[model samples]
Target chain A: MCIAPVDEMRKNHMTMLLHQRDKTVQQGIRGQPASLTGCIDCHVTPDASGTVARSDDEGFFCTSCHRAASVKIDCFECHADRPAEMISQLDWKSLNPINHSSLLAINQQSFPYALQFRLETRSMALNQ
Target chain B: MNKIDQYRRKFLGAASAAFVGITIAPGILLQAGNAATAGQGVSDAQRWGLLIDTNRCEPGCDACVQACNKENGLRSIHGPKTDAQWIRKVSLKNRKNGHVLNMPVMCQHCAKAPCVDVCPTGASFKRADGIVLVDKHTCIGCRYCMMACPYKARSFVHEKLTDQLPHAPRGKGTVESCTLCVHKIDRGDNTTACVQACPHGAMMFGDLNDPDSAISKQIKSLGSQQLRKKLDLDTGVRYQGIPV
Candidate 1:
């Protein structure tokens, strides 16, 4: 269920993310497993209004833990904190569709609870 | 050992192996993947450069300047003196002969960039592919690079920024200048906004290291001159048809 051991991820996730950013930005490497977009797509939670939350939102995954640990997250100053689809349609177009589809498949299978809520809300809106 | 015990031992060994493999596979795969893409990294093998035919440049034509502003989302919020001008059109006239010419000037992207040398924080740097860039993350807002640059290329962000492009992230209190459209270059685009916007083909962008490249061929055939060549910066940008 976890990408890595919870203890390891908790302790070294920032280092891992920083390393990934350097590789992706400086070296032009994309579609890596430690991508920030991939993490946001999986870990982002919706608010009571059924909209994906922003980084400043109280219960947002990264912010919630970072706040508890007294660590300030500066990434969202330039990067979108929510899922790609929620941020910009242009981003959705630019994203590698193969990675998107594969991540979607894995997300559906592994995190059915989150997927079901999103699906049900989408379907309800479609019916209306 | 009994058959049942032997079977159980085999299962335990297999499970342990699988666990180890699963735990180690991602790191190994990541390394392989990085190696596979290392060829895509910017390298000294190809130094990207520009050739500007100043004779072809039209006076009163600000297309290149306008295009750069639009591309990088730079606006003159504070007046011309304080605003960032990544690229500017310069007009030169011969005092003795009455000869006149117009040209665009920007960061020279020098081989031995003074800005890179003068920056105490090492934020001003030249990439492997000969592109000069300011790593804003480490820039401490000192204007040493600005003072060091002979072309007067670097600009210090004096005001807050809003509605910034995600690809070209600009912030307050950072020295920035023409990155030679590095984001576009990294995305595999060969031309900069100025080059693309030049209707008269006044600007050319290509790999200077490649003899077959248009910029290189132009430089060789016509003999381009670098601005302030006496300084021996070996600038990536070359100019042609300017009255001496």
Candidate 2:
């Protein structure tokens, strides 16, 4: 399932990602729903060939749309294009969904109004 | 510089520098409350810090350093000179007695970090909670922050890095350093990887902003020292038992 409808995501993902990147990088907010990592986790998967597609590949999730629009993105240059599980062989605690931290928090005043519907107070992201 | 002059210069700074202590929050002395969930930005009210008891740090123990590399997925085919070492065991030996002391050193996470000042693109920054990080998106690989750092903490990625862990995103040409295990911190796992992996319990990680924090109380009771204290960096990392 998508976080938002296909049309809505296609239209405004860049802006949502922009907000998420700044918050995560500068403000140390990782619980936000629009994180690029979150998107890659669900979207960038292996096909029947059992090969995971990189951003440069035409069959890649982000690349297919971006290539169609002729919009070049540099996000994959520094960020991991693969899912967390695919990147590291080590069984890091962070990669385990069972051990993943709660992600319900996102109620800062600076957050976008449209996205605030799903936002909850900081208390919602209590450490489990 | 000659040996004597170098010795004099080093001592000159050490002479003026004193022990680092907890001077904030007169009497509150209460442990900081739990952090808000993942959705929230790290609170400025909590300044993360590490306290290392060098007296307890054992020689030849690389647990903390190994843990750091594993946690950050930092692998290197090259030797020490080119390899990324976010945390390394620093051995200090007394000239006369040949006594050896050991401690782990990484980014000090300074309150007034010089790396933040020298970055032309503002990529080098201190998080409001006191974790120093290089925002690779804004970093142009200029390496000015690397030079400005007094701790020699930051390292530049020379070759194309493939398959970096999501928890620690690194790339070619950008400068990076110790993040104090920000990924874990943001997830509300309060301890750093180095501190977690230390077998001797030589390291402590906590919120320095909280007067009652274990680290703050330790700094209060035992006293700690910041390396190169003459610079007055107000480093987040502190050490105990540096033979001054």
Candidate 3:
């Protein structure tokens, strides 16, 4: 089940997200009913062809509703629309070896920094 | 700015926001008084801090810098003039004996942060837990806080940023600095990227307010001093082994 009913989320998701943002940012409270990253993890997924839809794509989760309403989502401008694990699963060929640290943490699943050396070495090797 | 760069930013953002579900630190709940919330609230009861052991810091190693860039999704834009360097390695040399000291330097996260004092929009503020941050929501990109910072810690985003890490949402027209990985801290991660990535264990982090915490104990036992101590900023980060 969704955090809220799909209709309820559609109507008031922005307010909920903002509330969560403030609570998390200012209060350091992590538990909440809604968050941008949590929403992306659930709503957005790559196709079997290994391609995730961009915000511009009509089939994209947020864009599907917003495009018809003609409201643009400014969230994805700074926040990633996809979860981090999915980004790592993306093929290395499509990823910019220099511009991004994607394709990191394939072996280490602990903390984000657990695999920094591996990522640094991987990106350096790719650059060469 | 271009198509590939936009795509790359999104990918990098995901990469950083990913790997956040690791196990919580062992002593997080062990800390007393604040035990009721399971580390959910930010209060002055806990002052987050880092102690860098300069003796262990490798002179040429940039692991901490690289890890910070990867963790925060910071990439060079034009060059040194416009790059957002949240953490950097600096070497200090003495002409008398040629004594050299190299250490990682970023936002000192002072109790009396100059950036927080100068922000016109109240965007630069300190958390109750002593993590100084730039509130991107209210920031007007005035660059006043950047000018006031004593450690030269703050940076302004000149080019439009895309696909910023969901946890660390930065954008153009805003000044940003080392958040001390506030996103990770808020989520109950005990250490920051630079501390965790240090190959020589040069960096240690914990609640500075807790007497029993490793950071406080080490600062008491091993001894450390802040940068610009005379400024009376009461910095959260402290350094060890700076030559006299």
Candidate 4:
């Protein structure tokens, strides 16, 4: 079995949770899926009537998992809390790794000096 | 003026509703007690904290990991992998910017912890002062806490904790993660293994609760972000963007 990448270990763990949380949403629990795999799957918009799915709603198949696991979830945090099909119109590729390296480099140099002080203090303690 | 009148009407409606039913939401009530639940005295004067600047983080050093293992009495496994890592170099590539964010992964020590909630036996909990931890003796090895964690910071003991120092105590079957060096912290030591092992000044730890604390002040002025805001974990750990 391919264990998750060390960097994405959290994602890997969430995937297992989603599977384990199967069929438990309506029983008065709140274990929603993590936003790692796909945002649209969890962050669905309301129906055409402008009503969003509730944990007790029949169509909120996704919320069911979260409810069963008793994990309180906020869907709008990752997916656009608008409508279901509209999510497809959003750019999911921005979440991919295409331009991540360059962004990391640009943001890398600006770390603050206070962080430096903590590191130095620890170094002295451990050495002794 | 019609637009202004419309806004005023909406505000009045909300204000009236609030007055009629002034019951504070349970979530809000829980928030007040959260600070005290961690079991540490989090005074405004001294809030413990940690910082890992990805720009400065380097791989292959593993000095912090070595020291943590030694201090915690962890045995070296087949790979340099062990469950008691207070720090590990994590490589991240920002898909949007293509920036390689090499960070040292550890517990964020979140203010609102999901891991603590999911633990059926209450083995996992945050101290009053805000250190998230596990009582190994009480842990049943369910790994439910691990699954609930958004940062993937918790680790499982696959084998027995061996070759440990007489003073260092850890073993198998329970979940473990970075304790912010609780033993060191309890002894009034500010140094953590990762902070000392780092040849570069990559990882920083301090009191975020303290207004004058370095990490707190840096977070306010620098605008760092938690790893996953969507989770609403309210993590004390913050990171500056990594350099190209």
Per-residue error at B206 for model 1, in Å?
A: 0.4
Q: Write the per-residue lDDT of candidate 1 for residues A1-128, one digit (tens) a residue.
A: 55678899889888888887765555456556676777877888676887776678777888888888888866765455666455443432232112222322332243222232234333211100
- Predicted complexes: DockQ each: 0.04, 0.15, 0.12, 0.01
Give the DockQ (C-alpha) for candidate 4: 0.01
Candidate 1, position A36, lDDT: 74
Residues forming the 10-long window of minimal summed lDDT in candidate 2 chain A:
A98-107
- Rank all candidate structures by their lDDT, best first, as comma-separated numbers: 2, 3, 1, 4
Output DockQ, candidate 1.
0.04
Tens digits of per-residue lDDT for model 4, A1-128 = 22445467434655654543221111111223332223433444557997666434546655666666776754322223334344334344332212323323322332232133224332211100
Per-residue lDDT tens digits for candidate 1, residues B71-108, read: 77676555555677787666544444555667777899
TM-scores for all candidates: the values are 0.69, 0.78, 0.78, 0.52
Which candidate achieves the best lDDT against the true structure? 2
Residue-level lDDT tens digits of model 2 in B76-164:
63544467768756565554455566777789999999999999998999876888999998899999998888777888998777667
For model 3, residues A2-63, the per-residue Cα lDDT tens digits are 89987998899989998777656655666566877888888888899978887667889999
Q: Comparing to the true complex, what docking class would candidate 1 get?
A: incorrect
Can you list the residue pairs that collide in candidate 1?
Answer: none
Candidate 2 lDDT tens digits, A1-128? 87899999999999999977876787776667788999999998888987799889998999998998999998887788888877665454453221101111111221121122123221121111
Give per-residue lDDT, candidate 2, residue B21.
26
Candidate order by TM-score, decreasing, is 2, 3, 1, 4
Clashing pairs in 3: none
